[model samples]
Target: MKKPLKFPDFKDEDKAADWLDKTDFSDHLEPSDLKKINLPNLKSTKRLISLRVEESLVEKAKQKAVKLHIPYQTLMRQVLHRGLEAI
Candidate 1:
């Protein structure tokens, strides 16, 4: 019988990262180590369209997005959606 795989505890994030970088985890993993997980499908219907806007507006959006910790494109989508709803 094969020995069960074990993971060593690391003192810090850097140590963990170093261990992961040097180790091939697949070599130690067994079928029993796997777990079944059911995650909701995140498929969305979004079309890619090219549109031109002022460079200043895009820069403003990017700055605001950084403050809000979201992507500029997502901020633009939310702004457009809100505008459409208001109309």
Candidate 2:
């Protein structure tokens, strides 16, 4: 079996940050640089509840996200939005 590669330890935050900044990301923008879209604000909304799901189900969703190269949270949000629209 092939062993996973290990990264070298860095002593300073600046050095680590600099290395990451130089890494190629295929022309992706930093989070702060992205254009913001105006969505309807839900600040006045209340009664939001959080639910826990089985670890296996969460892992399955994460695996699907990895396969599609998108964030798992984004996939979950889209699914929730579609379900609400159907109701």
- Error (Å) of candidate 1 at residue 56 is 0.3
Could you tell me every candidate's TM-score relative to the true structure?
A: 0.53, 0.41
Q: Write the per-residue lDDT of candidate 2 for residues 1-87, one digit (tens) a residue.
A: 233323345555434545666665435555455455442322332245787989897888899999989999767765775699799
List the lowest-lDDT window of 10 residues for candidate 2.
37-46
lDDT of model number 1: 0.75
Q: In model 1, how many backbone clashes occur?
A: 0
For the record, the alpha-carbon RMSD of candidate 1 to the native fold, in angstroms, is 14.6
Q: Model 1: which residue pairs collide?
A: none
List where candidate 2 sits over 4 angstroms from the true fold: 1-49
**Per-residue error (Å), model 1, residue 72:** 0.2
**How does each model score on lDDT?**
0.75, 0.61
| True-vs-predicted CA distance for residue 1, candidate 2, Å | 58
